[model samples]
Target: MTKGRRRTTRDADHESFDTAYDAIMARWPDGTESLTVPTPYGPTRVHACGPRGAPPLVLLPGGGATSAGWYALAAELSKTHRVFAVDLVGDAGHSAPDPQRPVRSVGDLTAWLDALLDGLSIGLPSGPPVDLCGHSYGAWIALHYALHAPTRVRRTVLLDPTGCFAGFRASYLLRALPMLLRPSARRVRRFLEWETAGGAPLDPALLRLQERAAVLPAVRPVTGPRPDPAALRGLRCPVLLLLAGDGRAHDPHRVAARASAVLPEVTATVLPGVSHHVLPYAMHADVHGRTAAFLGPLSRPSR
Candidate 1:
């Protein structure tokens, strides 16, 4: 009888885990159009814009960026495609706790994304295969997802991807060391000027937004796995890789060549005189127009 009671308690504990996982998955910002889809890992949040009936394009933001990061891109893409920007789980923004015990390694990241897509009902018999666009670390996620779930991905665009270039390493010290030493407005202004290279001036409000984002509690160090050349070579989907030619750390031409050499089908473009941060703003209109043209002829026919 004691053994039986212990077995019952164990079952109860397992049930508790399931319940907590479910609750965490379901917790998302209220009033936003959200879907809680179950993945192998955990539930994921999918935020959308544009008509539901249109073809789907998934947007993956850079590290520490939430789904809101793709606001401008989504607004532009939504004219033709149903845009869904996903907040990567276990990172900043609104995403459920990872289902896997200890979310480390490239395989784990791929599995987490697979679970996210499953949870969101992203690709299925009724829905169109996804067209994915990812920026920076998000690009790495998109690339792995395509490799793991090729059938579910129709086309992929990697915007200012991080792992492709050895030189483009983003250092915490580069951003943090200065802030720690000089938190004054003058220092911040100087930093901003240096960061932007006195190019187009950023709106004061936009600068404030960047500042607030920097201070978010969830923003922390992220260690990324090295790129797998073999895996990249194996990808069969159509790919578009965009790089900013004038990015401080990344060499756009070299990175583009490396990506093009590995990906089976690829087109690489470099926007001259643009930095990593300014790419979205400087090349926004052009990229949007070009992307629309690229996807228009290729996207699956409406049912």
Candidate 2:
């Protein structure tokens, strides 16, 4: 690579963004390997750790947080499973989307995950059912995917999932609109600060990356009607739903009650004092301990 050539502004911005992203990823456990797997929608980037033969656990991060945001959670899960934290296509992070085959619908997003799992050699004939974990928007993806392919997912963990058991609060959406419609670093910081509401402080590196990503071009996230309550009842895989007591996204108690009633097998717990956006990284020890206990020991040694 030559360093003397003048770079375009977009190129420089991407480089700077990558630098900020890497700074946060530095917290990942030792020997974490970055892998790029080809999918029809795009080449997916995954941060993987854990033993080769352990049960596979796929992690999906919230919108804009990227796979790097799961460093803390991934480290703990890696102890018992072969953890693969994915950089969702069409979102922030190293994953690139092929404009020709954009993810335009929830179905397309699920198909992308199908291809990604195949590329990663997880699920179906290639390997055993995976343990899926997600946060916020990522949790929605995880839940949808579990419903989309129940046979392939052994268990699921959702951290303050939005749009699963309840809808977002009107106030939360109003606060987020400015950041969504016309993003700026200031808006990003303000939205997070407001949502986190003085909970445990967010990681400085991840916060910097979020601010940098605010202005980056992003494909509109695929959105649709929430999964039907009947469908939720039919999902056979056990689920662990962790809610934030102070979360303003939706009424956590309502979410818990609805989820407990609708989900055939679910354990819903609300962590007091935490807020929505910060739940993933804020309550590290509690999240890890609860998640590990729910997923249980690996089923069998990886073959």
Which candidate leads the pack in lDDT? 2
Across 1-303, the per-residue lDDT of candidate 1 in tens digits comes to 465455565455445434433343233233236555555545666777667677778888776455654555666777887777787766655465644554666787777776666656776666778888988788877887888788888888888887754545465238635754545445555555565674444534334444443433342334675467887778778888888666654677888878777778898898766666555434356577767776665655432
Question: Which regions of candidate 1 fall more than 4 Å away from where they truly are?
Answer: 1-43, 96-102, 169-193, 198-206, 219-224, 281-283, 299-303
Q: Which candidate's TM-score is highest?
A: 2
TM-score of each: 0.74, 0.95
lDDT for 157 (candidate 2): 95
> For residues 95-123, what per-residue lDDT tens digits would candidate 2 score against the true structure?
99999999988899899999998888888
TM-score between model 1 and native: 0.74
Worst 10 residues of 2 by lDDT: 294-303
For all candidates in order, the CA lDDT equals 0.65, 0.88
- After superposing candidate 2 on the true structure, give the runs of residues whose Cα lies further than 4 Å from its correct spot: 1-5, 298-303
